[model samples]
Target: MVIRVRDLVKRYGNLTALDHLDLDVQAGEIFGLLGPNGSGKTTAIHCILSLLTFEQGTIDVFDCEMTPDAYELKQNIGVVMQNVAVFDELTVYDNIDYFCGLYISDKAKRKQLVQEAIDLVALNDFVKFYPKKLSGGLLRRLNIACGIAHQPRLIIMDEPTVAVDPQSRNNILEGIKKLNQAGATILYTSHYMEEVEQICSRIMILDKGRVIRTGTKEELKATISLGEKITIEVENLPSHILENIKTNPHIATFDYDDHVLVARFIRGENGLVDLLELMNSSHLQLGRVYSELPTLNDVFLELTGKELRD
Candidate 1:
């Protein structure tokens, strides 16, 4: 395993941040850690990285004991936190080169690594620009470049895509894939469920300092009662058509309002075909139709109730 966290515990005085949380991240896998606001995800990561002194627990990284003083182990880890950590005074190239230099001492090798980092984030055009001059998306790219410039064996990224434009988000996601392909294990944390589903090889959802669920996207979805959710826009939904829904065992429930018919279905045969056939026989005009499978958000919502967080 790349990271093995066993019976981890952390506390802020009496308030427990992590409750004996146990986690395992396999080597070379893009592992995703997901949670709502204040869910101990960050606390767990800090504990793993030896940045925070936890109340109890042991974290093993790359088969070695991990601690704040484990410089050799620390040298192989790269971290890009939620907030950008690059220096405002340094230009883009210097920011990346400086971070990379922390691990690499040779000047010739550091220059090549810095250029590779710039190309990895596609920040070649902004090499001389200070961080303040770059757009939010470009700044985020620079943050990533600085972290990964050392070419560490393991990388931890927290909300790297947050607040960026769609194009930059795609670029970051693609770059993450390429990094994994190049033989680096990644620990990814994000509030964006779609991005997690897109890149994470395996996922663990944390809540209130404990793991609520852990599995692949399909496996997690299978644990829930939800299945496909279908929506059809109809000019006039026949009265009997709504009534006949009770007879269809495949369909779990439905709602009709504003000329839109939304149906949630149990896992079974195609509900769309059945709905269309029934509506056609009823002589109802279907304006538009959309069918969607259960998503990571559905799995997340099912496990964690829809309640506002601080």
Candidate 2:
């Protein structure tokens, strides 16, 4: 394991922030930590990095016990927090060079690493631009370049794609894949379900300071009762048909609006076929019919309760 936490607990007086949280990150995989705001995700990371003192439990990174004084261990790890941390006075190239210089003393090596980092994030054109002059997307790329310039074996990114444009988000995701291909293990934390489902090889869903489920995307979807969602676009849906769909044992629920009927089935394989047959028998003209598998968001809502815990 690249990182291992056993019975980790953090308490503030009588309130428990982390209650016996256990987690593991495998080497060379994009592991995602999914949670809402204030779900103790940040606290767990702080304790693991020895930034915050925890009341109990053990955190080991690279088979060595993590400590506040573990300078060597710290050198091999790179952290890019949710909040952007970069000097507005420094240019993109200078920012990357400064961070890389911390781990590499050789001037030539640092220069090469900084350039490589800039290229990895496709920030070569904006190398001379200062943070204050760059767009939100470009600034985020610079932040990534600064953190990853050191070429650490492990990289922890917390909401690295927050508030970025679609193009930049895709660029970041592609860069992460390239890093994994180059043999850097990554720990990613994000509340965006689609983002997590897209790039993560394995996922861990956390709620109330505890890990509720951990597995691949397919495996995670398997944990929920919802099997598939089938949507049909029809000009008109009879009132009786809508009522029948709602009352079906296989169907969990459905919504009808704007000449569209979306039916959700909870654990029925032939539900879509049945719905299609019913529509045909009723002479309903179906414009579009599509069946979709459960998403990480569906599994998240099902396992953590429908209520917003954040």
Candidate 3:
């Protein structure tokens, strides 16, 4: 295991932040950490990294117990947090060089590693540009480059794509996949569900400082009763028909908005067909009919309850 935590417990004053959370991260896989705001995701990560004091539990990294002074183990770990950390006085090249120098002392080795990091993040064109001069996307790439300059075996990325453009987001995600393929284990945390579904090999969802569920995207979807969502684009759905859809025994829930009528079914076969048939029998005109399988978002909502969090 790249990282292992057993009976992890953390508290803040009177409130318990982590309630004996247990977690394991395998080697050479992109593991996703997901939770709503204030779910103790950050607290758990801080505890695992040995940056914060915990009330109870064990944290092991690279087959050795993790501690604040584990410099050897810490040397092999790279972290790119949500907040951008870079030297405003330094250019892109110098920033990566400074970070790489922390883990490497030989000048020649540091130069090579810095260059590789720059190339990996595709920041060759902006090497001489100061951080303040770069765009939001470019700055994000630079942040990643600095974290990875040492070629760490385990990378922890927390919201690296936040507030970046779509193109930059794709580039960052692709670079992360390449890194994983090249033998680095990744612990990725993101608010975007689609990104997690797209690249994560395994996913863990947390709530109230405890693990709600952990599995692959397919496995997570299977855990919920929601099977498929059928949508029909129809204008002006009548109140009677909307009420009738709510009466469906097989349907878990449904809604209509903006010429779109969406129905969610619970492990039902031919749900789309039945919904379409019902629409036809009601003399409703359909513009577009689409069927989609359950997604990670659906699993999250089902397990955590469909209520907005603060």
Q: Which stretches of candidate 2 lie over 4 Å from their true place?
A: 307-310
State the lDDT of candidate 1 residue by residue for 1-310, as single tens digits. Answer: 8899999999999999999999888989999988777888888888888889998889999989899999999999999888899999999999999999999999999999999999999999999999999999999999999899989999999889889999999999999999999999999988678888999999988888988888887888898787799999998676778889867888877899999988889865468888889888978777879999988777777777753132
How do the residues 1-310 of candidate 2 rate in per-residue lDDT, one tens digit apiece?
9999999999878878888988889999999988887777788878888999999999999999999999999899988878888998888888899889888999998888998999999998988888999999888888898889989999999889999999999999999989889999999988887889999999888887878889999888888888788989998789878878888899887899999898888864559878988888899888989999888878878887753234
How much does each candidate deviate from the true structure in C-alpha RMSD?
A: 1.6, 1.8, 2.0
Better of 2 and 3 by TM-score: 2
TM-score of 1: 0.96
Q: Rate the local accuracy (lDDT) of all candidates.
A: 0.88, 0.88, 0.88
- Model 3, 50-149: lDDT tens digits are 8899999999999899999999999999988788999999999999999999999999999999998898889999999999999999999999999988
- Name the weakest run of 10 consecutive residues (lDDT summed) in model 2: 301-310
Candidate 3 residue-pair clash tally: 0
Off-target runs (Cα >4 Å) in candidate 3 are: 236-247, 281-283, 307-310
Q: Which residue pairs of candidate 3 clash?
A: none
